[model samples]
Target: MSKVQAPELKKYMDKLLFVNLQGHRKVSGYLRGFDIFLNLVLDEAREEGTADKVECGTVVIRGNSVTSMELLAAR
Candidate 1:
């Protein structure tokens, strides 16, 4: 499979993104910034749990720990 390039994420800037991390953790937030390594900075981040969402103001996710990312509709 082709690798995800930084340029491909440009369109998602300032948009909501749902991120799947290793170990079944899931989070969603507005895209703030990123790097070639795929490390991401998200604003107003929130951890999604089975029953409720936990607020995480801002988070920087390590690239290697990311499993997948999905673009979400604007709120």
Candidate 2:
């Protein structure tokens, strides 16, 4: 599998992103910032489940918990 580098992630700044976390949790938000460790700061974040979406405002996601991330179309 291809790896995502820091520079590559830069392009997605301020864009919407869908992130899959461990334990099947999912979240989506606009990319705000990230660190070398891949820890992410999301603006207007929300936790999404099968039946509901919970508003999270701004959140900081630990890099280790992230399983995958995908860019999403503008809302």
Candidate 3:
């Protein structure tokens, strides 16, 4: 879904999410953990770019630092 509410997040746990962060960085990963404030921990995260992506094992992102997040359709 393009718009994600708090409740929707929980239902989509362990699913893929595209996360936009500050400084024009974007990532997609399995949604491992999150909090009420939107702080997130992503597993098997991949940094998006024009070239080959850099594999990020795991990432913890602060709630305030996140710009947006989109739930990706399951494969």
Candidate 4:
């Protein structure tokens, strides 16, 4: 029998992410990991029925600053 290996996940490990904390100063940080963090944040908001209050944007993080901001337009 032959064995198959799944494709390795690419390193977006250091990519910067800017999260606007709802009018609070924007936060810039190394996105070492995010999927789990995002889910947790969302889940908590859902339980409190406050998820609708959150707004999110994706920004390319460079060092400790945001490099660009763009809304995802439909194709």
Residue pairs with backbone atoms closer than 3 Å in model 4 (clashes): none
Q: Residue by residue across 54-74, what tens digits does model 2's lDDT show?
A: 999999999999999999966
Q: In candidate 4, what are the lDDT values of residues 1-75, reduced to their tens digit?
A: 976543231243444433444333444333444332232111111111233333343333222332332222211
lDDT of 3: 0.85
Number of the predicted model whose TM-score against the real structure is largest: 1
Tens digit per residue, CA lDDT, model 3, 1-70:
5755563478768988899999899998998888877889898899998788989989998888899999
Each model's number of backbone clashes?
0, 0, 0, 0
Which 10 successive residues of model 4 have the least lDDT summed? 39-48
Candidate 1 on 1-75: residue-level lDDT in tens? Answer: 997666468888899999999999999999999999899999999999999999999999998999999999675
lDDT of each: 0.93, 0.92, 0.85, 0.31
TM-score of each model, in listed order: 0.88, 0.87, 0.81, 0.29
Candidate 4, residue 43: Cα displacement in angstroms equals 22
* Model 2 misplaced regions, further than 4 Å: 1-7
Collision count of model 1: 0
